[model samples]
Target: MVEERADAGLYGPDSVTWRIHGNQSMALAGFRALSLQAVHPLVMAGFNDNTVWFDDMWGRLQRTGDWVATVTYGTTAEAEKAGRVLRRIHAALPPGVEPESGLPYRVDDPELLRWVHVTETESFLSTYRRCGGILRPGEGDQYVDEMRASAELVGLERHTVPASEADIEDYYAYVRPQLRVSQVARRNTLKFMLPPMPRWVRLGTPARPAWAGMVGLGLAMLPPWARRLYGLPGLPTTDLLATANGYAVRRVLSTVPLVITSNPAYGRALRRTRGPVAA
Candidate 1:
């Protein structure tokens, strides 16, 4: 029997979490996740309060990506440690009320976390399938099931999160009536589309066009209803073009060596877990 090492982390190398989160496409799909999450006024309000200036935009996201990387690829202990750090940070944030609804909010609230979690995994699955990553038959559902481990890490009750695409769609149905772009959400959308870049890159390189195009494609990959919610034209034609572009982007990214593309924590985990599993 090919037994996985005891220290293979929460989901191990064979997991859907690793496959999705480890991909370069996840970086591209991140805008979709953030865009969808911001439809909730409270979620958007929380993000609005934490807006990073200048290059800090990417810096903050990089820190988040590192946390995800550690959670996905670190040893079980390491993964739990990363989760504790996040919970502590979330706990420390002051609670606020949404101005319009007067609904008080906490970032660590389980319901809010569930919304974030579902939208995030939806974005990942959509990107994976549309960007040429294969999903055979029931594996999509399996992917959803496996991600409960992550939900548990982020202070969510695993049973409360969606465990399949159908469940995700149903949750969206319930939340759809409440979804709208508040002023905060609108600002969140704009910044996500135009993240800060160093002056030289902005002026000299094709950075603005390149980055905007990628963000646009990410937005296009969202469900038609979601794209419409953002006031973007969600024509099937747009999806056709975006899918082609995303496929090309994924292919190009795949050419870069794993060592170059994967985060250092992931690299170390692979080294620790590869080959010769002791029962």
Candidate 2:
């Protein structure tokens, strides 16, 4: 087992990112981020060509989740190791042409990396706030500033990544003209947000409602602009409904036992904060 190193990671317990990332509401944010990411042709092309997500969605989720957990809560050494592994994988991706624009695509392209970092960070923070995670004045800016360190681990230049909440919005405005819902984006949105049920789950009526509810909730959490790009409702009421539903789900999840909701890295971080486990 990796040794727990309290306050030895990138952000430590006091960072705004640590608190927001530890909340269960981040799962919803993660889905929103993926949806937003799919709208970028280069990002989607790279993902389609480079990943095995189509064949093993759960495996991809697990692997990505593990990386995020480690970087967010693990010791400094563990986070560094995870970063090195990711950098190696990115470096080795074969150059490919984006099908939509015929533009060359490289996994390690700094611009592309910055896009992913900004979109993901914005989504995570947005979701955290929407779900009632409180933030102090300037904490949102601090969260973005702190996340730049993690972005650097994956080949993004610290300067290229936004370092404040205002900067994040500015970056999004600058990039908005470049985003569109291509066929890849539409296909991926459907696959990820409303995946086909397995035979067992399909045969069982009881599971279907719950699955649909979750899918609807995820779709509802998407930004209005993203929804508009995908031809979804972009009305204010739509956002209100999504927010209300998200809060309800967050409330329910808050009741889950920590052992069930907390992944290993988060659990370790919690223990560290609490000053070690009792015998």
Candidate 3:
């Protein structure tokens, strides 16, 4: 348990960053971000060459979540420490060439890092708004502007990350030609959506399907253009259907008791700012 302190960290309780990242819909947004990230060939190549995601998928997800939560809600010192560690790790990873582009890349490549940041920021904000979480006028841009700090943490140039919805859309349009659903992309993307389960659990219980259903809600969170890049046939009512299901999923997940669902870093920050706010 984190005791009370005066520090409010990078984004305080009153920030739009907190307003969005603190929402339950963030779980869904994470899955959506992964799927979106895989669309970039260089990103797929980086993951394929540098990570052991296939061998320890659950650990990969947990680490990703922990890093994001720490940087978002940990004390300023803690957040900066996490950033330094990430930079060191990225710097040590060996470089590789993307198969499609025949170009060498680093995990710390500014362009690739920018892509990851924009996609995640877009995914989180879009999920929060789409799933019925409220944001006052222009908070969307504020959230995007705020995320530039996170982008910097992951080795992106502070000025390079998109800072508004229009800039983000422009970035997507510029990068669209480079996005495609390759065989490797498909394989890696499926790993996030359908995680490995024990044989007995798969056969005897609804666990896999139930979990997949939640991930499906994340897929539905994808932008229509992304779905098209993945070759989804745009049915007339898919958006309507998906939006309804997204509302249900958000409501259910939101109802999980705070004691059970609170992120540790967020809980600590709450105590620091508001004196034992988390149960």
Candidate 4:
């Protein structure tokens, strides 16, 4: 077992990642990242073969959100434990076969792991910036640098992962030739993301509009290449509209009560940072 530390897991309160990820608006970033990841055939193969995400999207989302929250805000021991569990799970899974290439893929494959890390980090940082999360000059790159340790925990090589914003952009450019929309990607984009509203949030209700707007914002936040892959508009005007919508949502969510927005893991980290309360 990893030893517990009083300090925050990987990023302290002052870190750019903590500030960017703590905002509720980053939820859209996660959505955008998933869409981006799905374009990789090998990644989709791994998800299709090993997970029930297609059948239970909400459950997958909740589990993913919990893992991200824990790693981002849990103490050192907690984060290491989570990492170990993930590594073990990945190791135990059978090799996935890419439908197009007929080549076997492993969950712990360094290249595949690098793809996941790059897409997620790029999406999160881009969305956070677009949503008005403030970052000092070079802090965005610093966030990428800081995430190297997190990526290593999940079987990515530090040297293979992008270490700066420019590196991320170049990596995406280099990998663009290998990315294309697959049937699985299309199904996930349409079903999980913009599914018909549940009966509970009936049409014409106040909650319906908010729910619809959130889904729309998620679609709009997809990168241009991803949008094109999904047959969505990639015009500059569309980009502008998406940016405006994301900013609006960010502004509104920023006002949400802290008690409602803050996760339990974050609370524990805060307590650790501030030390125990006096009787």
Error of 3 at 7 (Å): 1.5
User: What 10-residue stretch in candidate 1 is worst by lDDT?
Assistant: 46-55
lDDT (Cα, 0-100) at 186 in candidate 1: 78
lDDT-based ranking: 3, 2, 1, 4
Number of the predicted model whose lDDT against the real structure is largest:
3
Write one digit per residue (lDDT tens) for candidate 1, span 1-279.
Answer: 766654888888888777777777886778778778888888877766644533487778888788777778888898899889889989999988887788888888887898898998889898888888887798899889888888999998888999999999999999888777788777666776777777999999998998888877877887888889889888999888888888899898889998887668767777888855575
Q: Whole-model lDDT for model 3 versus the true structure?
A: 0.84
Q: How many backbone overlaps does candidate 2 show?
A: 0
What tens digits encode model 2's per-residue C-alpha lDDT throughout 114-210?
9899989998998888888889899999999999989988977788789898998798889989888888878876677555668787786656666
Of the candidates shown, which would achieve the greatest TM-score relative to the real structure? 3
RMSD of each: 2.5, 3.5, 3.6, 3.6
Residue-level lDDT of model 3, residues 135-213, one tens digit each, is 8899999999998988878878778889899999999999998888778888776775677888999999998988788
lDDT by residue for model 4 over 158-180, one digit each (tens)? 88888999999899899888888
- As a whole number from 0 to 100, the lDDT of residue 189 in candidate 1 is 67
Model 4: what TM-score? 0.90
Evaluate all candidate structures by whole-model CA lDDT and list the values in order. Answer: 0.82, 0.83, 0.84, 0.81
Q: After superposition, how far is residue 278 of candidate 1 from its true place, in Å?
A: 8.2
TM-score, cand. 1: 0.91
